[model samples]
Every structure is written in C-alpha cells, then in structure tokens.
Target: MQKVRGVVARAKGEPVSVETVLVPDPGPGEAVVQVQTCGVCHTDLHYREGGINDDFPFLLGHEAAGVVESVGEGVTNVAPGDFVILNWRAVCGDCRACRRGEPWYCFSTFNAEQRMTLEDGTELTPALGIGAFAEKTLVHSGQCTKVDPSASPAAVGLLGCGVMAGIGAAINTGAVGRGKSVAVIGCGGVGAAAVAGSALAGASRIIAVDLDDRKLEWARGLGATHTVNSKERDAVEAIQELTDGFGADVVIDAVGRPETWKQAFYARDLAGTVVLVGVPTPDMRIPDLPLIDVFGRGGALKSSWYGDCLPDRDFPMLVDLYQQGRLDLDAFVSERIGLDDVEAAFERMHHGDVLRSVVEL
Candidate 1:
C-alpha cells in the first residue's frame, strides 16, 4: 500500500481538501496509474454537490492522463511507463453490447476491485470510477487506453471526458461530415469541441450558440463559421437564418435543458439529426411538443452517451491528430493549476469564463 495526497469531498456542499489517501497495490484486472494531468471537469463538481448520489467523501476527479505504475496479474493491455488516458468505460467483452459489436454501450463496465480509503479506513467513491486527482490512482486495466507518448498530457487528458464527449457527439452520434451544416448549442468545453469536431469532419457551416460572448469567441477559435448569442435572439430563428431559411443539417443540444432541447429540435432541416448530449436533471422532462412533429420532421432523435465513443479506437486517434496539429486540443485548456486549486476552479465553473482548468500533478 502507498499513501498519496488527494482531493476529497467529505460532505455535500463542503469544500474539497487534499487528504491522505491509501492506495492499495493492484489486484487482478487492476492497475495503478501515476496521474500526470487531470482536467477539472463539471462532473467532479456534480459529485461534490451530492447531485450524483449520497456517496459521500468522494474522490473527485476523472478526466486524466497518466503513466502506468504497476499492473495486477494477467494484465497485458498496458504496462509500466506507458502513457495513457484513464477512461471510465472498461467494457466487458462478454456483455450483450460487446457481443453485438457496440461495446461503447457496454452495460457491464468494470472498475478496480479493491478500494482506496482514508486514514480512518472509510472507502472513497470515485467520480466515474476514476479518482485521478492525485499523484496515483487505481483503475481496471481496461480503463487505461494507451496513446501516443509525444502528445502533451494536459492537452490529451481531456479526451478522457468532456472533450471526447463533444467531439463524439458531432462525429459519431450526429454523423456530421463533409458539407454538413451544424449548430451546437452551449459553447462550453464540450460545445466548443463539437464545433471543432464538425470542422474536423469537413462540415461546411458550423454555427455556435451560447449566452456568453466569451465562449462564442472560444468556439470561433475552434472553427465555428458563425456565432449566435441566444440570450440576445431566438436560437432557432438565428440558426434558420444562418442556414438559409431551412435549418442546420445536424443540431446538437449540449445545454441539456428543456428550452435548449426544443430549440435544437426546431433548428434542424427536415429529416435532419438532433443529438442531445447535455445531461439533464432527473426532474427535468422533455418539453411539451406534438408527437406528430417528432415523427414528421425527424431523421433521428438521439441521446449521446459518452458521445457513443469506444475509447481505445477514438482516444489514440484524437491524440494523434493533436500531435500532428490537425486538431487544436491545446486551445481547450484555459489554465494550468495544482491540486490545491480545484475548489477555486469549481467556483469558477459558475461564471462560465474558463474552457478548462487542468491540474498538473
């Protein structure tokens, strides 16, 4: 066993602190990773708010890149010294999703069998099964996807979560491609990434919509052809005007709210795709809309889970693109911070000023 300083949320609505955490040696199907860079994700903030569950004293970071420190028996997918991005989806090859060749939706994904604990021996519930806001963390071997060592750890680590989700929402779920007209609602990290993904897939017109002009500027840097300040005008009408009175070919709802979702539903050309990538609270229901409209004007209505990405296939590929300069992964990282700065980072989330604040261990 080894002890490391880690960010821990001891209770709901309380500040997270760097605590002494005990990490066990990896057991079967497990590996210990020395985290190099971990992005301050909104999900981590969600865990702290008790919004995810009553799982208290949670270990609070997930989007991370690291090096393998040790592996348990029978592990061969990655090894010590390998550069990797820690993923939450460790697909069970025998699950129904995997057998049918859609392992990205693997219903039986696994995590480390053992637990990391506090000095008093209380178990820590890791956010998304990856508690990487520390010097080292334990995870299922399958969660460690090997990527190019040459890429910046801070830049590529984001592929583990929001960045990947946004990109995947565009390329994989929305099927955005050459000459497609796309509009992504919510110009946050994920939305910006969707804009970038549309460009990467050769989309002709990419319109970015957000309340904040700052985030809209960030979207432009990432390849948005036009910007829409939805707070100033109706999102659907602006999207229609930009798309020549029709609508976007693909509309992504990254805001995950009833109003934004309805806008996305209307901001599409007939037989166009609408993707819901934003996470909505349990109480939030689908907005009141006619059932006939859903049937009449739809190519597809889809909800993107992890952007329907298979990390092993996607992570390395995206990292390679970043390494080659075809994809500007670095633009998403607005600030570099230390572990102690996470609480302040979480506070910064409310204002929506930053794209990403990455913690370098």
Candidate 2:
C-alpha cells in the first residue's frame, strides 16, 4: 500500500481537507499514476457542496495529467513511465455502445476494482472515478490516455474534462464547420472553449455571450468574433443581429439554466443546431415552451456528454494542436495553485472570474 495526501470532501457543505489516504497497489487491469497537475474544475466544487450526490469523504479532483508509475498484472495498454491524461470514460469494448462502434457513449466505462481508503479504513469515493488531486492516484489502465510528454501538463490536463467537453460540443456534437456562424452562451471555461473550437473549425462569426465582461474578454482572446453582454442585451437578439438577423448556424448553451437554454434555442437560424454542454442541477427543470416551436424550429437539439469525445482519439490530436500553437490551451490556466489552495480556487470559480485554477502536485 502507498500512503498519499489527497484533498477530500468529508461532508456536504464543508471545506475539503488534505488527508492521508491509503492507495493500494494496482490490481488486475489497474495502474498507479504519479499526478503532475490537476485542474480545479467546477465539478470538484459541486462534489464538495453535495450538488453531485451524498457520497461523503469524496476525493475531489478529476481533470489531471500524470506519468504512469506502475501497472498491475494483465495490463498491457500502458506501462511505467508513460505520460498520460486521466479520463473518466475508459471505454469498455464489450459494452453495448462500444459494440456498436460508439465508444464515446460506452455504457460500461472501467475503473479500478480496488478502493482507496482513509486511514480509518473508510472507503473513499474518487471524484469521477479519478481522484487526482493527490500526489499519486490509482485507476483502470484504460483511464490513462498516452500523450506527448513535452506538452504542459497544466494546459493539457484541462482536456481531460471541461475543455474537452466544450471543444467537443462544437466540433463533435454540434459538427461546427467552415464558415459556420456560431454563438456560445455563458462564456465560462466551457463556453470560451466552445468559442475557440468554433474558430478552430473555421467558423466565420463566433459570438460569445455572457454577463461578465472579463469572461467576454477571455472569449475574444480565444477567438470570438463578437461579444455580447447578456445582462445588458437580449442574448437571442444580439446573436441574431450579429448573424445579419438570421441567427447563427449553431448555438451552444454552456449555461444549463432554462433561461440560457431558451436563449440558445431561439438564437439559431432555421435548420441550425443547438448543443447543451452545461450541467444542470437535479431540481432544475426546463420551463414550459411550445412544442410547436421545437418542431417549427426544425433543428437538432442535443446535449454534449464530455463533448461526446473519444479520449484516445481526441487527446493526442488536441495535444498536437496545443504544441503547434494553433489551440491556446494554456490560456485556460488562470492560476497555478497548491493542493491546499483548492478551496480558495473554488471560491474564485464560484465568482466566475477565472477560467481555471490548476493544482500543481
């Protein structure tokens, strides 16, 4: 067993604590990763606040990149010393989704069969099956996606979750294409990424909508062609005006609220697409809207699950783009912090001022 210090959310609505935990040697099909860096995503904060579930003493980090330290018996896909980004969706090839060739929606993703435990012997639930805020973490070998070691771990790690979801929302789910007019609502990390993805996909007019000017500025840096302060203007109207009154070819709602979703639905031109990447709370419900509007709009309405990405296929390609300087993955790292500062980072994220606060191990 390996003893490692990791951040843990001991209870709902309590600050996370860095505590000593026992990480067992990898069992079959498992590997141990020495974490280099992990991004402080909103999802971690959600886990701490009990927004995700009642799983207490939860290990609270997910977006991470690391080097493989060891692998258990029967593991052949990765070995010690391989640099990798940890992915939650480790596709199980025999699952229904994988059998049909859609591994991105794999019904049975893999995780380590053994559990990490607190010193008291209480089983610890790893956030998203990847408690990576620690110095080292154990995961299924499939969760480790090999990438270029030379890339910045802090930047590339973001691709493991939020950034990947945003980019995938545009490229994979929305099918954004050349000269397409795109609008991304909410302008947070995911929305800005969607904007960047739209630009990368050769979108001619990328409209970024958000309440905060800072986020709008960040979106512009990432490649938004227009910015809308939604607090000061109607998002749908601004998007339509920017698109010459036809609305955009694709509209993405990175804010999962009913209001933002409604804006996205109305901000698309005829036969345009709407992609919802933001996560909603369980209690939230879509406000009533006419079914005729849904049918009359005549466009696809979809939700992006981890940007509908296949990590093995997307991670390496995105890393190459980052290395080539075409994709500004580094811009997402608003701050680099130690593990102790995660709670503070969570506060910053809650205020919506920063894109990401990455914890360097």
Candidate 3:
C-alpha cells in the first residue's frame, strides 16, 4: 500500500478536504497510476452536490493523464512506466455489448475493485471510479489507455472525458463529414469541442450559438465558422440564417435542456441529425413538440454517451493528431492549478469564464 494526497468530499454540499489516503496494490485486471495531472470538470461538482448519487465521502476527479506505476498479476496490455490516460468506462470484453462488437456501449464497464480509503479506514468512493484528484489513483487495466509521454498531461488529460465527449459527439455520434454544415448550442467545453470536431471532420460552415460572447469567441478559436450570441438573437433564427436559411446538416444540443433540444431540433435542415451531448436534470421534462415532428424530422435524434467513444481506439489517435498539430487540445486548458483550487474551479465553471482548470499533481 502507498499513502497519497487526495481531495475528498466528506459530505453533500461541502467543500472538498485534502487528506492523505491509502492506495492498495492493484488486484487482477487492475493497475496503479501515478497521476501527473487531472482536469476539474463540472461532473466533479455534480458529485459534490449529490447530483450523481448518495455515495458521499467521494474521491473526486477523473479526467486525467498519468504514468503506469505498477500492474496486477495478469495484466499485459500495460506495465510500469507507460504513459496513459485514465478512462471511467473500463469495458468488459465478455459483456453483451462487446459480444455484438460494440464495446463502446459496454454495460459491464468497471473500475479497480480495490478500494482507496481514508486513514481511519472509511471507504472512499471514487468519482466515475477514477478518484484522480490525488497524487496516485488505482484503476482497472482497461481504464488505462497508453498515449505518447511527450504530450503535456494537463492538455491530454482533458481528452479523457469532456474533450473526447465533444469530439465524439460530432465525429462519432453525429458522423460529421467533409463540407457538412454543423451548428452547436451552448459553447462551453463540450459545445466548443463539438465545433472543433466538426471542423476537424471538414465541416465547411461551423456555426456556434451561445448566450455568452466570451464563450463564443473561445468557440471561434476552436474552429467555429460563425458565432451567435443567443442572448441577443434567436438561436434558431441565427443558425438557420447562417446555414442557407435551411439550418445545418447537424445540430448538437450541448446544453441538454428541453428548450435547447427543441432549438436543436428546429435548427437543422430536414433529415438533419441532432446529437444531444449535454446532460439534463431529473426535474426537467420535454413537454412540447408533436410526435409528428419526431417522425417527420427523418434522421437520427441520438444521445452521445461519453461521445460514443471507445477510449482505447480514440485517445491515442487524438493524442497523435494533437502531436501532428492537427488538433489543438492545449487550447482547452484555460489554466492549471493545484488540488485545493477545485472549489474555485467550479465557480469558474458556473460563470462560464474558463474552459478548463487542470490540477497538476
């Protein structure tokens, strides 16, 4: 066992406290990763608010890049000293989804079985099963995807979750193609990523819609062809006008609200695809839109689960693309801070002022 410094949320709606915890040796199909850096994401805040579950005393932090420090008995895919990105979904090969050759939908995805605990022996629940807001984190061997060591951990770490989700929303879920016109609503981390994904997929007219101009400017930096401040203009009208008055080939609702989803629905051309990457609250409901609209729209209205990404296949390829100067992962990292700054990072996330604040371990 090893003692490592980590940030833990002791209870709901409480500030995370940093403490030294015990990380046990990896069991079968597991590995110990010495985390170099991890990004503070909105999901971590969700956990703190008990938005995810009642698993209190939670060890938060997940989007991270690290070095494999050790491996369990039967592990062969990765070993000590390998650079890797931590993924939450450790797909089980024998699951029903994997048997159908769609491991991305693997229902039996899991994390390290061994638990990380407090000094008093209280069990700590890791966020998304990663618990990366620590010096070291234990995870399933499948959760560790090997990547180039030369890449900056702070930059590549974002790919483990939000960045990958956004890119996959367009490239994987939306199937954005060359010269396709795309519009993405809510230009935060996820929305900007969809814009970048569309751009990388050779989208000719990438329109971005957001309530904040600051975010819209950031969206343009990430490859948005046009920007619309929805606070000042009708988002659907703006998107439609930008896309030849017929709307885009694909419209992604990164906001995940019924209002935004409806905008996404009507903001695309006939038979256009709508990808919902944003998450919604349980109290929220989509009350309007006739059933005929669903049938008449004529294309897929899909929800991207973690951008529909298969981590092993997507992470390395994206890192390589970043290395070749084709994809700019570094731009997403607005700042880097220590573990203590997570609470402040959540505030920034609320203000929509920054893209991502990474914790450099």
Candidate 4:
C-alpha cells in the first residue's frame, strides 16, 4: 500500500480538494501507474456536479498519461517504466461485442478489482474507472495502452478522451474523407478536434460553428476553413451557404443539445451523415421532430461513444501524427495547471476561456 495525494469531490456542486488517498498494490490483472499529466476535462466537472450519478466522494480525473510503476500477476501488456495513456475501455475479449470483433463497443469492460480509498478507509468511486488525478493510481492492466515514450505526455494524453472522441467522430463514425464538406458544431475541445480530424482526412471544406469567438479562433488553428458565430447568425443557414447551398457531407453536433442536434440534422446534404459526439444530460430530451422528415432524410443519425475508437489501434497512430506535426495536439493545451488549479480550470472551461487546462504532475 502507498499513500498519495489526489483530487477528490466529496459532494455534488462542492469544490474539489486534494486529499490523501490510499492506493493499494496492484492486484491480479491490475497495474499501478505514476500519473504524469492529466487533462482537466468537463466530465470531471460533471462528476463533481452529480450530473453523472449520486456517487459521492468520487475520485476524479480520467483523461491521463503516465508511467507504469508495477503490475500484478498475469499483467504483461505494460510494465515498470513504460509510458502509457489511460483508457476506460478495458475490453473483455469474450464479451458479446468483442466476440463479434467490435471491441470498441465492448459490453464488459472492467476496472481494478481493489478500490483506492480515503485516508479514513472510505472507498472512493473512480471516474470512468481511471481516477488519475494523483501521484499514482491503480487500474486494470488493460486500461493502460503503451505509446511512444518520445511523444509529449501532455499532448498525447488527451487522446485518452475528448481529442480522440472528436477525431473519431469525424473519421470513424462520420466517415469524413477527401472532397467531403464537414461542419462541426460547438467548437470546444471535442468539436475543434472533429474539425482537425476532418482536415486531416482531407475534407475540402471544414466549417466550425460556435457562440464564442475565442473558441472559433481555436478551431481555426486546429484546421477549420470557415467559422460560424451562431450567436450572430443562423447556424443551419450559414452551413448551407458555406457548402454551396447543398449542405455539408457530414455535420457533427458536438454540443449535444436538442437545438444543436436539430440544426445538424438539417445542415447536412440529403445523403450526408450526422454524428452526435456530444453528451446530453439525463434530464434533457429531444423535442418533437416530424416523423416524415426522418423518413425523408436518407442519411444516418448516429451517436459517437468515445468517438467509436479502438484505443490500441488509434492511440499509437495518433501519437505518431502528433510527433510528425500532422495533428496539432499541443494547441489543445490551453494552459498547464497544477492539481490545486483544477477548480479554476473548470471555471475557465465553463466560461469558454480555454480549450484544455491540463494538470501536469
């Protein structure tokens, strides 16, 4: 057993604090990792707000990169000193989804058998099974995907979550490709990544739509060819105008709101695709839509779960792209903050002041 300082949210809507956490030795099929860099993603804030569930005293922070410190019995995928990115999808190879070869949608992912706890012996629930905002964390060995040690930990770590979700939304789920016209709504970290992915896939036109000009500017740096300030104009009409009145070949709704999703549905070409990578709250529901319109639309309306990514295949390839200067992963690092700065980073993210505020240990 080892004692480590970690960020914890004790209750809903309360500020998080750094507390002494008890990390146990890696049990069978598990590993202990020394976290190097972790991104301050919105999901952490959601966990703090009770938006996810009533799991209190949550050990937050999931998007992370680290070095393996030790592994338990039968753990061969990673070892001491290996650099890796943490992932939640630790697929059970025998699960129905995996047996069919769609491991990305693995229905039986697992986490560490033993729990990390508070100093007082209270067990803590880890966010998305990672809980990496600490000096060290314990996870299922399958959660750690080894990547090139030469890559930037802060840059490549983001591929563990938002960045990968956005990129995969475009390439894997949306099938965005050369000569395609693409538009991404919301222009936040994930949305901007979708724009970048579209560009990387050789899309002829990439339009970014957002309410904040700062976010739109970030999208441009990431590879957006055009931007729409939805607060100033109609997003659907602007998308149509930019796509030669035909509409984009693929439109991604990264905002995950009813209004934005409707816009994406109408903003794409008749045979184009609509990808919803954004997550909606449980309280939210899609409003009434014309069933006739749904029948008339000959395109797909899909949701992207973790961007429909296969981590082992995508993570290394993306790190290579980042190292090769093909993907501007560093641009997403709006700021480098310490563990204490997480509350402030959430405020900045909520206010649209930054793309990503990473916590570098």
lDDT of 2 by residue, 1-361 (tens): 9999999999999888999989999999999999999999989988998999897889889999999999999999899999999999999999889999999999899999999999999999999999999999999999999999999999999999999999999999999999999999998989999998999999999999999999999999999999999899999999999999999999999999988989999999999999999999998888788999999989899999999999999999999999999999999999999989999998999999699999998
What are the lDDT figures for the candidates, one per model?
0.95, 0.95, 0.93, 0.94
- Where does model 1 exceed 4 Å of error? none
User: Whole-model lDDT, candidate 2?
Assistant: 0.95
Q: How high is the lDDT of residue 61 in model 1?
A: 94
Q: Model 4, 27-74: lDDT tens per residue?
A: 999999999999999999999999999988999999999999999999
**Candidate 1 lDDT:** 0.95
Model 1 residue 248 lDDT? 98
Supply the global lDDT for candidate 3: 0.93
Relative to the true structure, candidate 4 reaches a TM of 0.99
State residue 41's C-alpha deviation in candidate 3, in Å.
0.5
* Each candidate: RMSD: 0.6, 0.7, 0.8, 0.7
**How do the predictions measure up, each by TM-score?**
0.99, 0.99, 0.99, 0.99
| Candidate 3 TM-score, true structure as reference | 0.99
The per-residue C-alpha lDDT of model 3 at residue 34 equals 98
